[model samples]
Target: METMHKGSAGLVSAPSLREQARKVIRGLVITGQMQPDQLYSVPRLAAELGVSATPVREALLDLEREGLLEAERNRGFRVVSLSLNELNDIFAVRLLLEVPSVGDIAQGGLSDRQLDELHQLAEATRQTADTGNLIAFLDTDLKFHVQLIATLGNQYLAKLVETLRDRVRLQGFASGESPRDFLKQSANEHFKLLDYIAKQDRSGAEATIRRHLERSRGVWGSRHNTTQAAKASVLDESS
Candidate 1:
């Protein structure tokens, strides 16, 4: 029997198939459809998606490289479980890097052209959110941050932040809040950060980054905990 799936019809090429499979599996993880600690084999995912196992296997290996999944030898992949404390630790490392970097940028100051570019990125971030293009908005947001860090003229530092940001991107999708609301909040924070940068306020910029990181951690961490608790309660009741 051919397993029918919505994603099976859109394949233009093998690479596209792999990319699509990756996105679908990532969405499953973000939405909690795929539970942590459960092994998901390539064949099972391929059957579910109505696609060949090759693309699904490649996608799982890609995700495993991203730290979101752990491959068991001779077995399948498992989504890595993250706790609130672990989330906090990620934010702490971000703060340690981002705060000083932004502060340095502020003290050094941005040229008018650079400032305008930041302003445009901030506007794009907000508009993308308003228009409900969450993924595009995230990409824009990342560009803005990467540019901000790059202003310090340290390639290694900027690259480190970029890598860390990629690792935490999944958190943006797992907030459990309404998409528009969460996106709007994120856009507002970007604008505020830009405001401090425009004024060349070192202390203000550092403080804003700290507050933003903490608030983001709190919002997503809280929602994640609530969701887990609700799931646990349901299982307990059933048991």
Candidate 2:
């Protein structure tokens, strides 16, 4: 069953469907509406997503293989929790993949139309930031980068980038943590990345992405630390 959200097109049983399903489930997990280690019921997810169980199951299996979920003994599939070390590991892999991929995108020389498309995405991000719509800003920011690399003409490399993005998004980044400054900072990074790509500066693009990912890791670390402290304080009060 295909239902269209306003301003969004219909979903067919195409690659687009897979991507849409992925977005829905990822948003659910990241927003904490679906907790880490909670069991994933395919039928329930399908109903929520307004799709069949097949797509839900397929999407979950794909996410599981990407290390976002684990096999549970009794409770179907359990969402994977990100420990500090695990988060660090994700950043490490991101550096290896995205940093170099950005360099490749710069050196590969995007078409004029592609460059224009990226600029439009940048403007969309800027507008989202100005309006304090951080979620939309992050979505456009991700679209800019993912579309840039995906257009670089490597299917597997694009898939790798998308998978890593799912991991990052599932960390609640889409919700924009800390303060508005953090959102502004991330949006600025995308512009900087676009500037480098526009100038065909491969090294600059690579360096910028590495820095951005490192800063992302730092922000997430701070957010987690704050959350942990708050939880501890609550426990102290309770006990």
Candidate 3:
């Protein structure tokens, strides 16, 4: 929950103001404060952050480069919305990275300390879910999965997975679904995945990961369908 402040006089060595602005804006996008498909004025955002327009504009351009936002002609930027197809594509990449990599890790084996750490994370994720802390649950859940992949000792692969996860997070925020049921189910699956890895059951681990991904995809798909249906109903009423 740390953010780069725009007007912190006590701070030293502010090398790149744009990078700090980018981090602040990226945080807004990730935390669901900035809704998708909505335009945000650069001047307004800068004023809110207590900085000049230049850094905010540059930061927004960086987010656009990262596929999180899109610039309008002579206007401000809009947070990009992910379609169902794009969500599926992201899951496809996750499966490509996680299933094989985590399966390998499971088969190769984990040290007792690593297993214990994963167990603790899994429990923390479940507790967060029970309390209906969606943000905390999501954060801890990502940490669990990312740590799982890190066991392979490949920084690039782990980074790829993390990027894919950030995209997935966008979809989750846009879904507008209730946190209680979906998060509880997700936490349960995390435990099952940990069990598979601890037992060195590579096949089980692979299967569990597939199910987990499919469950997440299904939840997001349901949200998208509901939104579309509501829009269609409104259109029909208007017509």
Q: At residue 14, give the lDDT of candidate 3.
A: 70
Per-residue lDDT tens digits for candidate 1, residues 1-239, read: 22323442334455478888887776565444565646887777787877888898988998888777788887788877777777777778999999999998888889999889988998889998898765567668778889889988899888788766655544435423447877788889888888888888999989988887777677667766776797899999999
- Sort all candidates by TM-score, best to worst: 3, 1, 2
Task: Give all TM-scores, in the order shown.
Answer: 0.77, 0.73, 0.77
Task: State the lDDT of candidate 2 residue by residue for 1-239, as single tens digits.
Answer: 12212222223566666677766665555544455535767665666666777777777777778877776654466666677777778778888888878998888778889889988987887777777654466678778778877876887877777677767645453233425676677778788988898888999999888888888788777756665676789999999
- Superior candidate under TM-score, 1 versus 2: 1
Clashes of each: 0, 0, 0
lDDT of 2 at 32: 43
Model 1 is weakest, by summed lDDT over 10 consecutive residues, at: 1-10
Rank the models by lDDT, top first: 3, 1, 2
Candidate 2 — what's its lDDT?
0.70
Listing every candidate in turn, what is its Cα RMSD in Å to the true structure after a full C-alpha superposition? 4.0, 5.1, 5.1
Error of 3 at 163 (Å): 1.5
Q: 13-85, model 3: which lDDT tens digit per residue?
A: 3788788778667656765656664678888787767777888899999889878888997888877787778
Tell me which of candidates 2 and 3 scores higher on lDDT. 3
How much lDDT does each candidate structure score?
A: 0.75, 0.70, 0.77
Over 4 Å off in model 1, which ranges?
1-11, 14-38, 43-56, 169-177
